[model samples]
Target chain A: MKSTLDSKNLPILLPVLAFSLVLMIWELMVRVGCWSTDVFPEPLRVIISMGELISDGTLFKHVISSLFRVTIGFYLAIALGIPLGMLLGRREIVKHLFNPVIQFLRPISPLAWIPLSMLWFGIGDKPAVFLIFLSSFFPLVVSTTAAVISINPVFFQVAANFNFNRLEVITKIIIPAILPSIFTALRISLGIAWLVVVAAEMIAVKSGLGYLILDSRNALRMDYVIDGMIVIGAIGLFIDFFMKRLGRIDSVFWASATR
Target chain B: MGHIVIENLRKEYSNRRHFSRSPGSNPAEYREIIRVLDDINLEFEDGEMVSILGPSGCGKSTLLRIIAGFDKATSGSIRIDQKEVKGPSPNHIFVFQHSALLPWMTVRQNVGLGLRNIEDKARMEEKIKEYIEMVELGGFEHHYPYQLSGGMQRRAELARAIAANPDVLFMDEPFTGLDFLTHMRSREETVNVHEYIGKTILFVTHDIDDALIMGDRIVVLGGKPSRVKMERTLHFPRPRDFEKYPELGKLRSEVFLMLGVPYAV
Candidate 1:
């Protein structure tokens, strides 16, 4: 399969070429009878604006602010969600008791909670972080619960045959068995958390990428607004990449093929 | 001493979806009880290997599960070594038909699971390697279950189960999905392990030849709500060639007829 020009390079080349085509089209739209650069910036103007933001270092500050919120909120959700999900998944009675309430709350949209969160935590990082937490918590719990329930029953039998106590059953059988699903759940929740952090920042705080975009629009610096959007998209891609790499850890490698 | 006595074991299951399907219908009409096993009584001598043969869904696996304490029998009792079976214990291990190795762990780690109680780390490692080698999985110790073939996975599971030092082993269709050569090879491997360990084992299989060739005693189950249709001690010795031994041939056809197969071919 290794010829003179490596066949493995084709997959990498294809995506790059496709993205370049998209950028050319974007530039063409601006060059032809499109709106002025201030109204809707071109790709080059966005890049120039990005360079200016980088030189001023405000971009880094905003990015870090957004990341900090995501980190705290995401960790909080994980710490609480996994244990509760496992408990609910293992015992049907507990699931039945609380699952309805959870289901009803899950679909309410974290955006709708903005007013309540602002009122409860007041406008600052606290409310923004709270909104991010709410965005991630429900999906994490739901996915973890489903993952635990979907585990192969034979592993439990194997656990029983070994005379596993409660702790051993959880650590040895349940945890390891549901690992792949847990990674998937983490990926999805992280995505939701990242998405909510932006919207939350726009409303409750003035130190994040979302605030940068809103502030730029008020000043009519449309180029800076476009730069903020570009940074958000780039960071979102990076988060997904990081999660995919995390899932490829040695423990979950066995599931990579099957999944 | 792993003698097991299963006395009049019976199992019944009501449809789990009955209530949801017809909520207001008569309870008796909606609740359909499926009888899986009925009045199964069997006794195994210490260190004997018993192969249980039956038609598909004849409750053969159900009976084995009950004996292993993975499932509750609707009624009856199972006594192992004079103690009544309550729930699954380390004294008995059941090898599933499908590969049940923990997907996240390597073969070495999987084998080490059964030896978790061993405090001496060196001894545990030694035992793990010994079992892995026993099943000819030594080179694949770091490989996961998905990385191995069907035969390798089964052997790995066998190593894991045997390393636990269970007194009674239950196998449900251990070679159902293997290719022809692997099936023959695994059956040989099972027979060898049985002779070496001399632990009482109860195995369920749909293959008649496996029972004839590998078991010290054979029990055939038939019909819905299955009952033991035939039980016999195979006195004809191992490596029993059908062409060479008239009695083996006679018994093979006899079993075929009993199982409702006309030609015996």
Candidate 2:
């Protein structure tokens, strides 16, 4: 029971300690009048600012908007990336045709697509979602393709000896053999998707944590900007934790085998 | 009813040219020359356990692979049960020297790999249980191959091979790396399984003791073309002892002579 309390106390404890340190330094500086509010706000003012954002519901709206964009883009990436990876993995001809194109596009930053995205789809959420998809797509596709092709040849021969047709060979043997690697790709892509969504929202017409940070900066609300950064960090951490849990469930056999 | 026939089998691996070396006066002489297996002819009968005993690079494993329908002969015909062998058969399975159990899968799943289409999950489970019991790996069914010891892994492979109920089981030096005592136990279990099912086995090994213990008849093969040097049939009854049959040592010397190896000191 004490251990459980210790574990539960961790989340509140570290932040509280860090907050206390920051507040002590800020209050000391403020008492000495070394810095003005415009330059560096006190910790108490930041807390009050956080409370105001929560009550106004603007913060909640931006958080939900960002979440919705990330979810859709991330799911789309998985849907498209997995099949594309399988194609590249299985067919030499297809891989050859697309290999150069993928190589050319992979290094282009997701943010670089903003201008072209706006020209193609107009502003609002489309550009943001597209940027997220672009960010997640390459890693997911490449990792899965590498995984599928890297499966042991012995397993392939075994499948052939079992009278497995092409479909059966792929579905029953190749997919299962490569599933662990594919799951690893999904986790990586999810992180990339979250990162890209924030970057996209900062530039292409806005309503997200990124926009809130920018807006607060323009309004001389440094406390609100800090709050937005905190929210982004907290959300990203939560999603990562959930992703790890989901990965464990999806790759139970793989996890146990590796262990 | 699978029978393998190899006639004038030839295999040659081409080597890449070296840019550092200038073209030779006789370019053909400079070409890489390796004739691993040349013009080999053989046949295997149904329900027979034939051991292919030879030194390294004698193409014994290659012959087994061709028989297993994994490799194609350069210019020879291989017929199984009088039908031309085109590719892998559903009723033929090859067991490598190393257990080669899929590391990701548990023993039970490895055993049931060939039976993926069996809609009746219970029946498949029962069959896996039966084979695991046969190899005395009942409690270790859920354990991965890597978790088990080397001997246990071979036993699991044996259970997997038998679970498929293949007509022809091809084993390529299945006990090569095992210690003497572990090798004996695994081979003993393999022999028991063979007795129970009566599947045609084409076993390849370099060990004479293994050939003597497990094979009903042994085919001694030699280097360069890998033709059969001699054939010996054991007339000893069940549970034969090596010490009691010192003749096996004499035979082993003769086989070693044919293989161009000196007899044991």
Candidate 3:
């Protein structure tokens, strides 16, 4: 009876317990150390700051802007990456020609492109979106290529035996075969895109959670900085949850379930 | 004419050894040409279920694949209905040893994939339903390949191959990896389907019992670079009971002996 009760309530109870324990420790540290609210604002102060930001519409504006940049950048990455990856995956000669360049670009950080993005697209939404796109594209391409390459050769043989044309093979077999792995890649690349957007906003653009954090920090509003961080973390978690649901759809059920 | 003719078929693979002779050093060696199928000649009349019986790695599957046009012979030619077999065609389908049912597709979809070119939606749907029911997967029509058991997966593949209405069906150990009961049931189902539709079947198997049970004619293959060792025609009628027939038991022993499995008299 006790074990069943524990199992039933644990999901909700544990997180709440852990959160309260952290808050208690934080309050204790502040009391013991006599730290100033300017250096480290307490949880209540952060909550109040969050309320002020929400009431004034600052939080929503920043969040919407960040979301918009990520959306545009991510879709662009998907559009360019998947087809190119499929082409390179199928053609050995093309892969061999471009593989080294892809590898070289893959390792370079998205932050490394910020200066160039600023020079090309200027200090606005364009530069931030460009950085997010660059950040997401490489991982997307690499994963899509791997997914295509790893598809069972038997599928192709079966396709051939059925006398499928090139278009039929691509649409029916290749696309479905690569979808599960590509969805996993989508999750990872979107997370990276989100991370890059924040960094890009901090430097390249003027309005996002990252900009809020930097702006609040410069003005010595530690509560607003902490609030910005909480918002960033919450949004990231939500995006990941959404992607997970997308991967669970019936068409790619076999691939995701195996993993 | 659905007759198949395989003439002097040969397949040689060059096995190049790439091993390290010294620590962390790559070593190069001369390539060795290994003949998997050496000068194989076989013929199958229309509507005949011929079993290519052999030991593992005896090129039985290789020959079946060559005829299906999934693989090319190094020399010689395969002809079906007086036409040269150059590539895979919808007229013939090969059922792989491992179930090749597309994991993403439901049983119905997998079975109907080959029939996508059929213009009549009602006709296509009817064929799909018919094959699914024939394979005893009617209720599980919407289940994915992974959701089914090993036996069901094999049945789904069989349904897929048969639904195509091929002139020839090349099956490479289609019933391997099933439980004993499931194996027997599936074998009976295979025979029933053959009787109903009457497609020419070229089945490859190492099991003497499978050969005896399913084949109208058993072609035994042996030797290092495999060739047809012997051919025997079973005169028994459909659904032959080997347990009741002493003649079949004697033939089974003879086939085992030909496969190099000695039996004490």
Candidate 4:
């Protein structure tokens, strides 16, 4: 029990210690007049601004809006990309037809789509969500296709020997076989999606944390900008933690553990 | 009714080394066919356990795969019970050399893979339980393949193969990776199971003793572009010992010599 507590406490304790050190350095720099207070506000000032946004509900509203866009976009991408990826993985002809096109599009940044997205969707959450979808779609497709292709040929032989029907092959053999890789892909694509959501919100939407960061900077409320930065970082960390928890499920345990 | 016939079977793979490694530098040498099995012919009677042995990479596995309909021969046919084999079917199951149990599935679920068409739920469960008990993997039914020891994993695979009720079962070096004691136990269990079920099993192995002890008929293949070097029926009774049958010892020594080994060791 004591050892377990020590292990758990280390993760939290070390981060807290580093955080306090950073805060101390920031406050010290401000006191030493590294820059003017207006441009680079003290850490305490940012904390006060964080509390202010929390009580006034602006931070909560922005967080929900950002998360809402990410959810709709990420889900839509997976809903379409995963099936298409499975098809490409299975059929050589389909891969030959679609692979070049996807490879061409994958390297183009989502930020490059901002002007066109705004023109097409005309502001609001639509463009931002579309950007998030575009950012996540290609990586997910590539990862899923690779995952499916790497499934052991032995399992396919097993499937054939048992006379598994087309539907049964997909449901029993392909899906479960690639599930661990799919989880890894999701964690990566979700990170990509989170990154794209911020850049997307900066240009296409009005209420997300990105907009809060940009709007505060324009008004020279550096404290509010810092608060937005901290919130985005915290939320990113939370999302990563959640995905990691999902990976510990019993079905996945077999793949991850050496046992 | 699992009698199998291989007629003038030939397997050749062109050396991809030139193209893949050099990338079109040696265009003329690309179609150079390296034959693995040359004009091979064999017959396996119904319900007979035949163990095939060879020098390593003598196409014992290739031959097994061809007979099981997992791969194609360049110019030949494999007929099982008078039907020409085209592809893998439910009538025959291949127990892979490695544990091919789907890692995500529990022992019960992996075994249940072959029992999918059973309409009665209770009957399906009963059958799964029966096979699990057959391999003495009773309590491990709920455990994943990863959680089990190597011996247990092989037993679970054995249970799965028998549960399928195939007419012919193909095992490609099924005892390749086990420890000595585990390998012995697994081999013993396999013989007992074969005796009880009386299914035709095509077993491929590198171990000469395994072929001699387990097979009703032992067939040895050797040399490059291998063909059957020796084929004989073991008429010696059950629990065959080299000491009890002097001929078994001579035969074992002969196989070792044929494979270019100076002594039995």
What's every prediction's RMSD, in angstroms?
2.6, 3.4, 2.4, 2.4
lDDT of 3 by residue, A1-259 (tens): 7874688898888988998999998878777786797898788888888999999999999999999999999999999999989988999998999888999999999999988888999889999888888998999889888888999999999999888899988998999999988889999999999998889999977798989989998999989999998999999999999999998899977886756
lDDT of 1 at A80: 92
A39-83, model 2: which lDDT tens digit per residue? 677778888989999999999999999999998888888899888
The candidate maximizing lDDT is 4
For candidate 1, lDDT tens digit of each residue in A1-259?
4663476888887878899999998888888955987897888888888899999999999999999999999999999999989998999999999999999999999999999999999978999888888999999889889999998888888888888899999998888878888999999899989899889989978899999999998999999998888899999999999999998888877777656
Span of 10 residues, lowest total lDDT, candidate 3 chain B:
B20-29
In candidate 2 chain A, where is summed lDDT lowest over 10 consecutive residues? A249-258
Q: What is the C-alpha lDDT of each candidate?
A: 0.90, 0.82, 0.89, 0.91
Among all candidates shown, the one with the greatest DockQ:
3
How does candidate 4 score on lDDT? 0.91
TM-score of structure candidate 1: 0.94
TM-score for each candidate, following the candidate numbering: 0.94, 0.89, 0.96, 0.95
Off by over 4 Å in 4: A1-8, B16-28
Considering just the first chain, candidate 3 attains a TM-score of 0.95
Docking class of 2: acceptable
Predicted candidate 4 versus true structure: per-residue lDDT over B1-265, tens digit per residue: 8999989999998765434457655566666789999878899999999999998889999999988888999898889999999999989999999999988899999999888789998999999999999999999999998889999999999899999999998999999889999999999999999998999999999999999999999999987889888999998887888998999999999989998997999
- Per-residue accuracy of model 4 over A1-259 as CA lDDT, tens digit each: 7875687689888888899999998899899976889999998889888999999999999999999999999999999999999999999999999999999999999899999999999979999999999998999999989989998899999899888999988998889877888898899899899888888888867899999999998999999999998999999999999999988998777778743
Please, what are the lDDT tens digits per residue for candidate 2 over residues B1-265? 7576777777766565655266555666456756667777777778888888988878889888887889877777877777788888778888976667777678888888767668999998888898899988879987877679888988888777777788899999998778889987888888888889988998999987788877888988885666778888877665766677887768777777777768764
Alpha-carbon DockQ of candidate 3: 0.79
Indicate the docking level reached by candidate 1.
medium
Residue A148, candidate 4: how far off, in angstroms? 1.6
